[model samples]
Target: MLAVAMLLTLGLGGPWSGAEKAEAAPAFAKGADISWVPGMEAQGYTWKDKNGNTRDIIDILKNDYQINSVRIRVFVNPSNDYGNGYMNKDRAATLAQRAKNAGMSIMLTLHYSDSWADPGKQTKPAAWQSYTFQQLMDAVWNHTRDVMYAMQAKGVTPDWVQIGNETNNGMLWEDGKASVNMKNYAWLVNTGNNAVKSVSSGTKTIVHLANGYDNALFVWNIGGLIANGATFDIIGMSLYPTASDWSTKVNQTITNANDMISRYGKQVMITEIGLDYNQATAAKSFVTDIKTKIRNIAGGNGLGVFYWEPQASPGYNGGYNKGAWQSNGRPTIALDGFIN
Candidate 1:
């Protein structure tokens, strides 16, 4: 008893003693990608609480669902491809402003195109389609700088910024296609990262990829990035399980996340994740399990998980079945998993 008291007084204890350390552990962040909110609201979609009270979805998520971070996607010129642009630079700035006002951390995902830029189609913005590789690199740097600058001017610096969205096949196709030409891809990626740092030095950068459950794909994409000298702060992943196979996906994602930290010495985050809309109970379980797995990662490198477009109810444009809201504009039980 005397020895134990002395050890406690000196802030030293047996190997099993970590009471103070455990108490100091930071809270795990619960996040959601509400990139479609602006567009959906503009289209006359309204969200309500479980009590049928109209509410700003952002407020509800943060206040009720315990979401602390919000993710928004920014397109170079979405209006160029679709009428009435949404997710463009100006709109993104506005959304970021709102998020900041709501006291939530912001994550800006730059698609780097007029529309969607993903594995199947990483088409360059129509305006930059004719630029040479070198010019394309310049375009990337300039656009990133402009967006970051615009957001900063609004007194809102993103806590995290994704250089590209689901860049499995690479971004700015033909010029920066990872599978086709890793050198160019790395150059563009590094340029974007540099641009973000120059504009907002405090903002962390992320290299996003789809299908967090695929270890081989991560090895192919992220490994290549590291090989080609493409640096980033975090490895962001998208995990969307089909049917009820979330268990497998969650295990694979945790494995990939652990490998990413051990192999590359970087942090990991689930930038986008969703389950079938009808599977609210399963979604809750998946979120809970995934969050636990991430927090359990050996180091404190497992950042957090962000549900992809949880407020997008079915029947709304781009309202995927995996959304976490019900048809009545109220959150489903799936969102409850974020409550810590």
Candidate 2:
């Protein structure tokens, strides 16, 4: 049995026992963009009161809700400018410090891109726009090292890190795409693995995939990594109930999540999850179903849940892509329904 399962089993009564202590299912070890706060700070987005009160992420966590760990994304340079919101190193430090001061852990997610990178799209960061395969590998190595050094030097070391985000399709674009060449993919992955191995030896490295409910894809993508002998500590999945027929699909996701532990002999976590609180009723339904689904997953195999951007007020156009940050005219739908 996996250690997480064993630990979870060694509890009061059986799984459904009300007396049993139910641990929180954290959506992301830290959470998404909020995790990017540190990087945002590095890019020059500061929280300054009209009175000139300089408060960074620590204030948000300290005031809004208590946080234990932070998840930060490293983009090559999202805004193209030297300093902008899409995660530069300086912003990450400030948030990391807040997490540290608040006695929280840190999870580093290397997006391998300058801007938004997800299962839907994997645009290679412009800086690496023209690098050869080998050059790209070096970029990954140097970038990871530089970021880790900055965090560690400031006394904020991450407890967990991800080589790339939702790497189901592959990262670093046409070059790192799965069909391009398995050897190339392996090389890119190893570059990140070695980077973490070099600086934060204590950190658990994670490799993430998207659409947890899709069983065959999960097997194929992660199975490929295993075949190539890629080393990582965690198998992470992103579950967005609103993305599909969630209730029916969640069962498959649970099976896939548990199977990963057996398949890889490693821990698993719902590295990214959110029900799209765009509608309160839907949000409630999504939250209730997700809570049940996650409990089942945790019960069968030790795992965690991570809600993405739960606290984010709806962005302009209701967080639609290419939209600005504008209120969605709804009450803050707390994604913490499962974890909190």
Candidate 3:
């Protein structure tokens, strides 16, 4: 039993109950995106608990902080020559398995690109660059189906699946850019959602956008998706506030999230959120407050909050620095925000 506990603590073994385990399912999700785990591990980044004991970062979050879920990002065919590679389906599946074995709910986010896809850029995968808009839709559907099936084959059913990450501007470039062509974008989203349902009827589909603090943007983007008949179970947001305006942004995000639930009649999630290490206090306050507000959303429509790359290795050159860990692998107080 001690060995089992250690395995669970290290996230190397299947689920087991302890004093720390929640008596019931988490009322409001506490999540982290450990998508960079493989890359970080490959680069020889080590993680340890406050006591200085080496541990799996996922296990630390789940066992120590009450985090009940994890989010992973998948890139279709990312360049893997460098140790910094990501988005490959196989890597994602392996990580998903770890989360599943830890008994945490999994959220899979598909970028639908060969590299990063976000509000600023949504370049299509190179293989599909020559395909028409309709062909692109087919590709999206097939890829979604294949990924879902792959995870399912490993006994990892994603509780939530995001069609695209931070897609306020839309995905797949000009061919499926919602701002440029709402019809094509809507088609891609719906098709991706359908494919998720086909593979795992239990998985909830989400359409993510950046700037959770911007209500008008959500209104514009989500309104457009609805106007064009896009279907999804959840509306996802990426909330990253600077130190100067963190409180204001949090307030705005809460208001926006409530409005989205009331107007669109759909649930919402903080699909990605982060704060600088220097803002450790603010980070804790921000995470706790936003989670409280989300939990209090009228009708319980707010699903949860997820911190993006909270364990990011400082050595990586991807410009990510919102991790809750200090340089020595010990967690900063920023992670304390998840305690509640």
Worst lDDT 10-window in candidate 3: 16-25
Q: In order, what lDDT does every prediction score?
A: 0.81, 0.61, 0.81
| Number of backbone collisions per candidate | 0, 16, 1
Ranking the candidates on lDDT from highest down gives 3, 1, 2
Error of 1 at 92 (Å): 0.6
Per-residue CA lDDT of candidate 1, range 1-340, in tens? 2233223224454332331110111245589888888777776788987788999899999998889888888898776432223578878888888988888888889999888888798889989999988788778878987898778777787878899999998999988988889978887888777667655656778999998988899998889988988867899999888656898889989999989888899999888888887888999898888888887888678888999888888755643688887887877788888876
Candidate 3 structure, TM-score to reference: 0.91
* Candidate achieving the largest lDDT: 3
Q: What tens-digit string does per-residue lDDT give for candidate 2 at 78-123?
A: 6754333466776666666666676666777888887767777778
The segments of candidate 1 whose C-alpha lies over 4 angstroms from its true place after superposition are: 1-27, 80-85
RMSD of each: 11.3, 9.9, 9.6
For each candidate in turn, the TM-score is: 0.89, 0.75, 0.91
Judged by whole-model lDDT over C-alpha atoms, candidate 1 comes out at 0.81
Rate residue 137 of model 1 by lDDT.
76
